[model samples]
Target chain A: AQSVAQPEDQVNVAEGNPLTVKCTYSVSGNPYLFWYVQYPNRGLQFLLKYITGDNLVKGSYGFEAEFNKSQTSFHLKKPSALVSDSALYFCAVRDYYGNNRLAFGKGNQVVVIP
Target chain B: DTAVSQTPKYLVTQMGNDKSIKCEQNLGHDTMYWYKQDSKKFLKIMFSYNNKELIINETVPNRFSPKSPDKAHLNLHINSLELGDSAVYFCASSQVEGGETQYFGPGTRLLVL
Candidate 1:
């Protein structure tokens, strides 16, 4: 079965500091990975996705993620964190089975403090 | 205009009652889906429809039935609602079945008394 794993339950970072939220996946074949962020009492918003032909993918809200095929990892990163960046993050993967469904990670809560 | 929209932002009903949550997307996407967010804040896919055809149906109970009148709308109907059914339900739409970004709605909070 294909699945995604977010190792960190929560991450705390200072404003203006680089932040990284780790995520790894397990799939039978090549993976199409995605990252989404959720604000309190709001729906999940798309951040970025890595389909192919690019190790680094940039997305909305000044967010970017690096895809590592060797380690089956797709970690989300931001150059400079802001207090507004504090939210819950989820990593997802679309398996080769072609169900048009995505397997999502448990999710990670990120807190950016001043 | 809202790309995706769901009706009854908040629902509170007694147990064993029936209710329905309606979803509509004006993005003209070909696929729509329903996801449940539990009390622990875990989101899980419940059902999906593509062009009015059932595409993905997860391990959801039969009490939960999804109906898609058209490609742009997918509605969830729950019969004999239970206490465990209290959670926020989100409706989403995508261009295709897989490998595409999904647009989500504001979500509907359902509570079973």
Candidate 2:
């Protein structure tokens, strides 16, 4: 089964500092990875995805993710974090050959302190 | 305008009662999906429809039935709601199935008392 793992339960970082939310995946064949962020009481918002192509993918809200095929990881990153960036982040993987259902990670709560 | 919209943003109902949540997508997407976000914030896919056809149905209970009246509308109806059913339900849509980015609605928070 295809699955995603976000090892960290919470990550705290200071404003303006670089932040990273780690994500690793286990899937057969090439993986389709995605990063989603959720604000309090809001639905999951798309941040970035890696289907096929360059290892680094940029997305909305100044977010970017690096896809590492060798490491089987797709980590979400931001150059400078803001207090507003504090939210829950989820890493999801889609089964390419299956029913196209997405399996999401447990989610990591990011706290960008001002 | 909201690309994907869900009715009853917050729903509080008594146990053993029936409730329904409606979803609509104006993006002209052919695929719509329902996901449940539990208290731990783990998202799980419940059902999916493509062009009014049921394509992907997970191991959801029979009490939970999804109706897709048209390509643009998908509704979830639950009978005899249980406490475990109290979670955030999100409706999403994509231009196509698989490898497509899904646009999500604000989500409906259901609380079974």
Top candidate (DockQ): 2
Off by over 4 Å in 1: none
Off by over 4 Å in 2: none
For candidate 1, what is the TM-score? Answer: 0.97
For each candidate, give its TM-score against the true structure: 0.97, 0.98
Clashes of each: 1, 0
lDDT per residue as tens, model 2, B1-113: 99999999999999999999999999999999999999998899999998899988999999999999999999999999999999999999996656899889999999999
Tell me the tens digit of each residue's lDDT in model 2 across A1-114.
Answer: 899989999999999999999999999877888999999998889998999888999999999999998899999999999999999999999877766688999999999999
* lDDT per model vs. reference: 0.92, 0.93
Which docking band does candidate 1 fall into? medium
Candidate achieving the largest lDDT:
2
Docking quality tier of model 2? medium
Error of 1 at A88 (Å): 0.6
- Model 1 lDDT tens row, A1-114: 789999989999999999999999999888889999999988889999998887999999899999999889999999999999999999999886567788889999999999
Score chain A of model 2 by TM-score against the reference chain A. Answer: 0.98
| Candidate 1 DockQ, CA atoms | 0.71
